[model samples]
Target: MSGRLSGKRIIITGAIGNIGKEAVRSFVAEGARVVIGDIDEHAGRAVVAEFGGATHFVKVDVSSEASVASLLAQGVEWLNGLDVLAQNAGLQRSGPITGFSQTDWDALFAVNARAHFFGAKHAVAHLKRSGTGSIINMSSLAGKRGGPGLVAYSASKGAVVAFTTALAMELAPDNIRVNAICPGWVDTAFNQPAIDFMGGANVQQQKIAALVPLGRQARAAEIAPLFVYLASDESAYVTAQSFGIDGGVYNG
Candidate 1:
């Protein structure tokens, strides 16, 4: 840990999720105080306990505006103020368009796309107060290039990309940097649902090997550093950008 984020205060939603858990570890190791916000109370508490200090867990259902607001309010109370917000809570429902139910579509967007907007809308004030703040939205490679069986999930993530771009311009004058990360195939349990939809774990990996130029999936640890960099002063000049960390899957 280089203390790159020393004295910073952060709130990471979906803290119990695969990618969110890695972000928590990376941020804390770099000396940031983080509030782990997630619906999974047990996992969130476990991370806080492991981190020992400078880490707090608050249960949050990002899909609700009230829940998002509460997370920010409680997080700010614990950390004194907010410096960064990682809108990482997301869900995916797979199926072809013809069979995609409205329930699935709404649920997917509620957490994936809608949550990003609410998370930022609630945190912007606290962020602006920091003088310079950062918001990292977790998108996906599926969003950039549509996935065959991920119609609902792909559309929801694509919404996040557009939301990030629009919100960046709106928040630029306040020194709040907004960026999105499009990850290809990161090894995490979160991929289990998609894998099951694609046939099975073996089939999924085979497909990834053929699709991803890297020929292998990335570990969660490999994706955590980008969150640190984007949230730290190291990327001060970087804003309004959608970074692809997808094993060379998306060139644009």
Candidate 2:
């Protein structure tokens, strides 16, 4: 009956999304109290409400300093301290450079890249006070390799990976570990349009699954434990590294 995250207080940004929602469940099931922050108030409340009063939900636009500040404050107030900060909010858009609008690029980066920056910045204060906290940033495989239509997402994820390394080094002295998880081809509804446009449901899925040596996309639940490991003493000495939960796509 040992709980890996017993008594831990975690704040997961973008907690309303598919993978984020699943992570919430994992964190809770492992005995951690979670505070969720996301732009989707309805989904965020609904999801957290499913767990009832045990979890806290906040409306946060990670791109906004005030929103990030408010969310962190609420989390700190509710949990008394913070142990894990999972920066998991992001968005993806497709358009070639020649046809891509600069506005689109800015908008996407605000949520996908800049939001990570702000979330970590604000969460750091409470985490540092909690002593020996862990920071896990959500990255994507697109950041590792270039794709024709995925420039913005790829670049943003690349930025997140780099940020993880640099932050890890800077925060190591505080015993605060920082890491990144780059997920690949998750079979969630997030990419449904791309899958559907590419072909029928089964065919599209098969094609994507074929890319990974494992012959399938990932599940959010599958990725959550990595965060738990990174957040726990089991990985006490692990930091500044990026682990790919990408179905052997990166072969790491």
Candidate 3:
């Protein structure tokens, strides 16, 4: 509403999901033109329809470098430029380290960690041209403080934080800012993996109530504002930081 991101062009990977959808809405509301990239064409198009003319959709498989490259290319072409890239595509698998399969670990890293690298690698040139670019990678509080049955997921997200920090310093000279958002206990189906691992929805809620200082989980909308701020020029001086949007779940 404040048009904080007026005239900005943004690309959000995994834009069909809970947090991604909210980020798209928030970005569009703030006057940014956005490209919604996801693996699901049906959902991606629906998101574009919901946002009307301010958005476009691109089908992308973030695990593949070629797909990631194509998404950025198509997105930059649609917006005629690029200002922000939000790497929100990720997957979670929760289980004890003793029985965790190599397949699961590799899959988690492919999306949760490697995708961010792919996105950043392809987005740099266009972002440099924009002169005021920002990259927002979605990490998790588990990435900061590992949890039970979350070994693989935590490792992947932690990789995102490390990559974001290093990339920020590498690109700072180009005026490109890179940062990571580490959220905790967001109440969305996206947490179904961890929820099931904990037992069920009831158990997940109980744990959230006990663990988080705020005694609850965050809504996707509650997490979207940070995306808006990081994407806007308001965060021009902010880079190489991992911001925790958790309900006081992480003290570090």
The number of the candidate with the highest TM-score is 3
* Native-referenced Cα lDDT, model 2: 0.83
Expressed as tens digits, the lDDT of each residue in 127-198 for candidate 3 is: 989887999999999889998999999999999999999999999999999999999988888899899989
| RMSD score of candidate 2 (Å) | 1.7
Q: Give the candidate order by descending TM-score.
A: 3, 1, 2
| Model 1: per-residue Cα lDDT at residue 5 | 98
What is the lDDT, from 0 to 100, of the residue 159 in candidate 3? 93
The weakest ten consecutive residues by lDDT in model 1 span 14-23
Off by over 4 Å in 3: none
For residue 28, give model 2's deviation from the true position in Å. 0.7
- Candidate 1 per-residue C-alpha lDDT over 25-56 given as tens digits, one digit per residue, 9 for 90 to 100: 99999999999999989988998998878899
User: Which pairs clash inside model 3?
Assistant: none
The C-alpha local distance difference test score for the whole of candidate 1 amounts to: 0.91
lDDT (CA) for every model shown? 0.91, 0.83, 0.94
C-alpha positional error of residue 61 in candidate 3 after TM-score superposition, expressed in Å: 0.3
